[model samples]
Target: MSLAPILLFTYNRPEHTQAVLDSLSKNKEAIDSVLYIFCDGLKENSSEENKSKNKLVQQIISSENRFKEVKITIQTKNKGLARSIIDGLNTVFLEHEKLIVLEDDLILSPFFLAYMNDSLNRYKDFKNVGEIGSCNFFACGKEFPTYFFTNMPDTWGWGTWKDRWNKFNEDAVFLYKELEKNNKMHAFNTYGAYDMEGMLKDQIFGKVDSWAIRWQAVMVLNNWLCLYPNPSYSNHIESINATHAKINMVPPLQNNEPTFETIEIKELKNVTEAMQLGYSGKGDYFGKLSKKYLKKKTKKILKSVLLFPLPYGIVAFFKKNKPKK
Candidate 1:
């Protein structure tokens, strides 16, 4: 079977870029599979240190020849991570029907490429299968199947066909309105286990710029299922400078090749419950309390502090000694 093209997005993280590249190059299919590197340009007012790092990243990419074909696109202007990914996907879909994607901070197992290619080929024509996710964050028991389906799409390491990606809607306003109007917010949040709805709202309000949230919104709206491997074929590496500061529990990488099978598209209750529990702050006392009450109360207090005309000294003291509860 033909291998799907791999697209790697990078910015100013040279060390991370090199690490991920080395890991991906170890894949059995790396020698024959085509690879594309999209290096985003430095932002406006970027410091010289950042410029140096970006240049180092480009240099590393340019010197790489591990793949059968290596294509590089160094942007002249900053497009941010969101725009860069959207544009990169569009550009690749023009030539290839499907492709795998990875960010600069992800490490892939040797069998990652094999699993992705197999799944892509198996589900290429299945309209219900929107994408193949390589990372499984959900805590599953040993009896859980090798693979399962969910409405949520993971971005850490994933692949999708042009047809499925073509339906991706980036309009945050439209997606929010539709979900709210249809009363699908609960399902969209994975039954209140996650703050996906809040993330979408943040995207709409300009508080955060996230392409993954928008992509998930599309998947949720269309009732599309993303296939996830049990022992995740990929894992994310946390970086101090990364946008997502929350550290995720990386599952053990798949040690051997997994067999792919055509299965009915449906969410597994056990897997769903596991995912909800994982995100619902079950074992942590502070997590449950914060999610259930502290967050809302804190937000209200902050709003009052910002809007109320209070003495400067008093406000400063209040902020300095903010209650930890």
Candidate 2:
């Protein structure tokens, strides 16, 4: 099998970067793969502390040559994650037909490279299949198959062909307008359980800068399918200083070795049963209770901290006013 080049994007987290690289190095195929590391520069008006951290990240990447070849690119100015990824993928795809993408926080299982390369080779000619996702967040119990098809594409750890990626629409406003005109907004929201709709609104309104949402929208708009493994080949070790920390829906299940040699590609339109279990926020008690419960608990804790004596006094007053039992 011809190995796909690995493109890893990183910021100022040196420890996270090291851990990710260490795990990747453990892959048997990684020794034969080429790695491209893109280190995003510091933001404007950034503190010296952040700049130092960014340097540390660069140093960590440069210190390792775990792959067949490692190339590093350091931006002079902060291109931000969205632009860095967009530009980095664009630059590398020019030289490579297919590539695997990863961030600094995702730790890979040993079979990650095998799965990605095998899937890329298998689905290279499948026009409707857009990307192969290595991480599965669905808590579909322990009785699931080895792999399955899903409509949603995940970014935790993934791979794609240049042909499929060419369909990506970078302009959010234009994509949103197209969705609105075609009356696909409802379907889009339904496919992602309102998550895609909210992300599109935020991206267009300048409330947030996201590239993954836009990529997913482009793929969905074109009716592309994503292949997902049942037991995820990667786990996201979220960074503490991350500006946008995603809420984990379930505990990541590990699969160090998974075989897809004889797996058939089944294009599923509505795998409602499995998808419903995947999105915790859309169907169950955990989804309903997560945000509201956290908010109430935080408020009570703050009240106790700020109005310590007052809260206790009020509690005592309320108890004293109760009828004797």
**Per-residue lDDT over 201-289 for candidate 1, one digit per residue giving the tens place of the 0 to 100 score:** 89999998889999998888888999988788988887777766366545678877577777777998877777676567652211123
**Pairs that collide, model 1:** none
Top candidate when judged by TM-score against the true structure = 1
Which residue runs of candidate 1 sit more than 4 Å off their true CA positions? Answer: 283-325
Candidate 2's displacement at residue 261, Å, is 3.9
Residue-level lDDT tens digits of model 2 in 118-231:
999998888878889888765234455666666678788999999888888889999998888887776566554556787898999999888888987887687777887767
Candidate 2's C-alpha runs over 4 A off are 248-250, 262-271, 280-325
Instruction: State the local distance difference test value for candidate 1.
Output: 0.86
User: What are the lDDT scores of the predictions, listed in order?
Assistant: 0.86, 0.79
Clash count for each candidate, listed in order shown? 0, 0
Name the Cα RMSD for model 2. Answer: 7.1
